[model samples]
Target chain A: MVIRPIVSGFPPNMHKVPVFADHLMLAQRFEHPFSQELGLTGFGLVTCLEGEAQFMINDQRLLLNTSSFAVINRGSRLMINVDETPARPVLLFFRSILADVVAAEIFHRQSGHDKELSYAELKDYRLTEYVHYTHASVKEVLEQAIQLSQSCASFQALKTDALLRSLLQSLGQENYQAIAVSARLPVVKQSTRVDLYKRLSHTKSWMDEHLTEDISLEDYADMALMNPAHFLRNFKTAFGITPHQYMMERRLELAKKLLQNTRQPVQEISEQIGFDVLSSFSYQFKKQEGLSPSQFRKQVTTD
Target chain B: MEESQWSKFKLRVNLNASVEEAYRCWATPAGLEEWFLRDASFKDAAGNAKDKNTLLQEGDTYQWLWYGYPDSVMEKGTVLKANGKDEFVFTFSLGCPVTISIYKEAGETIVQLVESDLPTDQGTMLQHFVGDSKGWIFYLANLKSILEGGLDLRNKKEELVDVITA
Candidate 1:
């Protein structure tokens, strides 16, 4: 294993958390404490900020080095033996209720829009089914929140809470997407055939930038330098759906991201993402998302 | 041509952490909540769900929760080989019709989360592919922050707008 320099220690008073809280200083030459213990319902998220160590959770064992983050969820039984005698593990433990509260509030906001009976006719998916983690931009915001938490600044705490909400909503969107797909519910509209083929010739970054615009099949065909009918047939031949379905799916995706990541009013969000008519936006969102905008916002607000 | 197939999205991440740490983060509960989400349970690779703390082994069926969708664990293929500390390949899925690949690079872990094998009939799947990738970008950012003594970034609505707009 490589020897990386240790950077810093845990946030002060982080150990004062209600759950199990402890800090250990560890280095390569130091010996570790070994034990087979079943922990309480609250588990710590342990990170080897620096140095090296080995930990065993149940039958699974792993070596923790610099920049490593591990969750010690509540109700877990594990054995630990540090290879590097003085290796330090910065641990933060909170009750399972914390996670539950986070999940419930976010889920409700993301999923609450489906109370209407007509909602039942819509598919069951949203936006999260396809992702597991977020990007650096989000992480940076989170880091800012933690830094803010340190000062007890009202603005900072507000900032932190806001960041947390965004992150959870992002997760909810992913979860919704997964459910929609597995239930055989229709997601990603079928009208985007031409755009799909055209995109095959483009890059992801480019498509992401242009997702919320007037991307008609003919326009996409022109962009690809192909005749409209030929583009249609070849696109169908390659992708299987029509150009329009493809566009709607892309639109739906943008809408989902906006719904999960932003608190913009439903009407503004609808227009920002290219839905010209509020009724059409609601109708299409219902068809693809299975929830109304207000319900989605309300559910996410709990976080 | 099947018109009802879902799309696939793939994301590659190179983390500053070790492979084992990354693996455990994905496999264990403590590690999952960092980059993944607050909800990390087990399920079969083929959509058959498994209970929490279920021993994860090659061929052990398991599924993972990704928002509202449950991940289907594909066949636990071989490690493709592990370099002891740095690099390893493991099997994870993107629910019903997609496959995912994870790899590690340098001090950073390169996770290639892929959701593939959707219908080719239209851009439906590919549209999903792009959108999901965008989502992954956000998740990966959150993961990096949490692991690096940063914040969880799970629920920052205003900041999210700032990031999106900026």
Candidate 2:
């Protein structure tokens, strides 16, 4: 009957209804960055809308920028941190019962009922920890689910049931993509390939947080706990792009956003994205965007 | 008019576009056509038709038609308030007032819609309260998709009937 916030509360006294369709889907928007060690009760999709945030889950520090999101598993302790610049994050937490039901449905449909025997217990939501981009359908459906979380709406529980199913289904697809993406590594064992891919992904996330710096390949290899040659080859194989190429892509993406949004000069924006020389930044920007940095700014402002 | 408990509801969507773009989507006749209506025409107080690109004023009366529906199914209403930017209020179904608020929130532009005041009889309650709420949710989602991703989720195929899309 009562709703309590996750920060500075005894515990989140969220809905615990019995039915899966009536499952509790609660959303909490954090106005400012927070720092606390709290245990999660269900899957929490943490999205950084404005600023950067650090989520420590299962001893891994995952940095979420505006372009990325992270999923926190149930029963995992999370430590959220934000610096002087505040990060606005929205968390969508759903009861495990909802995920379990969706998982059962997915498995039952995948394995038709003509089987001779059936397992009494269905699979639970044991999604592995990972960070993903906002382009995922999970993010889209999460936004839809958030709209129904309003207090004044009726049949919210009924409405959210469909969103939950789609969200879980999207997560299932994401997990499948994760495995498929890891298959890019030429390792003989699939488990080794997946584990190596996760490490490489973690390294890439670290570079995302520190985009403005000139990080060395040795440092990335060290962080990923692999030899530099091995890391470079596997990173290229798993992601289909070398680390440097991926870094440049992300840096330019950030540069375009800065150029369009802020009044910063071209040189300043160029340096902000880690281009030591303004000329090279402009060259790269023009190559990727088909327009010069100043030209892009002018086009945006005029439009 | 007796105000019933279930006559009004509010919904909002965070758009990837700017506040100016969000306002344009709901304020002008041509703007409404971009994401919402198939055709929109606004007239001044003197019954003169306003320009399609003209920003709607507070006293303007408007007629809007949808894409899938017939031209006979026009919605006639008057603009209640228009600040030329960021906010718009207009009369909607059954003369109910719909308020639109657009502002920057957490680095994204948000379009907040509140539709209120309706005849709370059984039929009107179901049509406006439940039906309109559900309808606005889809429209707002469609608006976000159109603005953010340039993908219109509307069911533009006239051959298809009984769809819940735009």
Candidate 3:
């Protein structure tokens, strides 16, 4: 399939806008399976308007149909595959500053106060990958954004900003609802609930910072000021995943980045992410990603 | 075909509130008065007066007044449909159909307003389409501000010009 670049440059007069850069591309026709390693410079939202697409982030695989979309953060390695014919997917990339604004709004709404958080700090708050099912309203808003980007309308920049804010807000609410549902409990005191959320956030941040180290459940539990068992349960309930699962996902994510961006050997990359043995790391990577480390690297690098 | 192509004004906003909370703001009289109108009341299909605090249901008739508007100036409409907490369809000034949809996205509530079935006459179209579009934009912004920041940016004074420079 021939990849058609629709809009590759930033809006010339829109420098003052929060979006630093934006690009839109369309695949003409999918004759053969295509894959590309996306070293995204900022936050990206990719929607499949017509056919199917596949995205691999860390060891997680997401399939995008007409109703589904993916949001990927910067500094992450993404492998995208298009196998279906007549696939027309649009990808929009925006600066991390825009993401930080959304993150700050969410934090303020949930925590009741705005804390100064840098782009890096906000990036750490993102899920490994966000895959959402779009309703008609969201689809219309996204379609409008694409239309505005393609148009030369004088207010296109402002219009696009408004649409993006709307999109981000929707995505934020979806994330919050997911957490609320997973951590289903009766209404508790606001102060206690906020404290619990803070502790959980700290635990996740701690995990991100120590992805390369040998960490224990006791350490995470202590960070949350709870017993090991209780911490494990609450963490799972709040995040919809156990502490071990979260750590493994983070390690794999780091390993994928090193493999794609650097010339590090697979064994060394494994060790860098806290894997002790080469064979075990390779086995686990292959089991989760459906390809060995070298093979995955070659697949991305050659394409 | 030409009439079917009448201009439609649509606006979307993501609020830092839940779907239920956002829906309430538009579905109930008290909720609407909080940020939208000055005085709002409704009656059910059976002509029974519905409490301002309760959610409006399908076939409910609404009488709405803006703060700066005179006592004689009031807008009347019917709640054509209210689909749970997700969608509410009602009639606005000049009988234009206004559809409000609320859905949870990411962790935020997204509220979308689409006003359609407008007059096709060129003069009427310009008056309602352009004028109401601008008004809706301000009202929507006020809705977001009031819900998220607890600040009402609406002009409650009668003498103040409501011109919003975008």
In DockQ terms, which candidate is top? 2
lDDT of 2 by residue, B40-158 (tens): 99999999999999999999999777765444345678999999889999997656899999998899998999988865766456535776787788788888988989888777754
Model 2 over residues A56-156: C-alpha lDDT tens digits? 87677878767777766566666667653655655555555556655565556546444311222223222346676543455555554554444333233
Q: Where is the poorest 10-residue window by lDDT in model 1 chain A?
A: A125-134
Q: What is the C-alpha lDDT of each candidate?
A: 0.45, 0.69, 0.67
TM-score, cand. 1: 0.28
| Predicted complex 3: DockQ | 0.02
Q: Can you write out model 3's per-residue Cα lDDT over B40-144, one digit (the tens) per residue? A: 889998988999889889899987666643333456779989986789999885567899999888888899999998767664454456666766887888899
Chain B TM-score in each of the candidates = 0.56, 0.94, 0.91
For each of the candidates, give the backbone clash count: 95, 0, 15
Put down candidate 1 lDDT per residue, A174-269, tens digits, no spaces: 334333332332226532432343233332223344667766766766754578886676555544566667667777777777888887888998
* Residue A297 in candidate 3, Cα distance off native in Å: 58
* Candidate 1 per-residue C-alpha lDDT over B124-150 given as tens digits, one digit per residue, 9 for 90 to 100: 243334434555577766666776666
Query: Which ten contiguous residues of candidate 3 chain A have the minimum total lDDT?
Result: A1-10
Q: Report the Cα lDDT for residue A14, model 2.
A: 30
